[model samples]
Target: MIRLDVSRIKNVPGETLRLDLNFPMDPVQSQHGQVSFNSPLRLTGFLTNEGGKLKLTGCLEGEARIACGRCLDLFDLPLKAEMDEVYCSECREGQGPGGEWVLFRGDVLDVTAEVAKAVLSALPMKLLCREDCRGLCQRCGTNLNREACRCSTDDVDPRMEVLRKLLKDGN
Candidate 1:
């Protein structure tokens, strides 16, 4: 649980507090897959007390262990996620713990789940081992990065049979 004590600036209206937290984090599941944090995650930002609502604006920096989409190899990926979250201590009459505004009580604010969600959403769509990663062979199931495959490139689509026959006769 990532909890930050905001007792110093709780009652003070329009007070802005700077927060910097560095700690080791466990693996978390994202939309693509599970991402492991081998290095300490750095969360640095400022919290502004707007009336009774606290606005958190910060950036999370960490390194994640991601699998390559092409070759399926695990590699270290440096990640940075921007966070702009809001937590209300004194909520509105109709507002509860669901929606854009998150309801919190007391001095300590637990932002573990929120941080994980932000990092997951900021992940890249494609995870590649390298820029010029040679993927496995489709026919022989051989990894092209390690060695060349002996699969023939003469395979033709059935629809191109007429074209092949025309080429043979024209030649």
Candidate 2:
């Protein structure tokens, strides 16, 4: 967990704290797929004490192994995310248009949940091994990129048979 001690900068408005850290993360499993980080996530940025509130801005960089949505292959996915958050001394529950505002309960600001949230949000909705990934065949479950499937590709849907017949008859 990443914790920032805000005891000194609590009341200082213009005081800034610079940070550069590497944190190890556990494997995360979601409905989409499983993601595993082989190395520590590198974070670099600064935090400013804006009166009693804290403003944090940083960049997170890391690599994760994710399953491709189309091909179902495990491949390395590069992770890069920018974070800008506000920590108010008072309790605030909603996100702002620019960023998010969270409540800081005590002198310590634990950013573990924020980091995980950022990384998870940065993940792609559809993971592809390549831009032109051919993916698996629907009929035979063949890897189309590596080899050709013998299944007929020209078969039309039964629902469109009436239209097909009309077109064939030039009607």
- Give the top-scoring candidate (TM-score): 1
What does candidate 2's lDDT look like per residue over 55-136, in tens digits? 9899988998888787788888899989888898874577454446787787889888788777888898778888777777
lDDT for 73 (candidate 2): 81
The 0-to-1 C-alpha lDDT of every candidate, in the order given, reads: 0.81, 0.80
Best by lDDT: 1
Give the per-residue lDDT digits (tens) of candidate 1, residues 95-137. 7445677778999998888889877977888787787777666
In model 1, which regions exceed 4 Å deviation? 92-98, 152-171
What's the lDDT of the predicted structure labeled candidate 1? 0.81
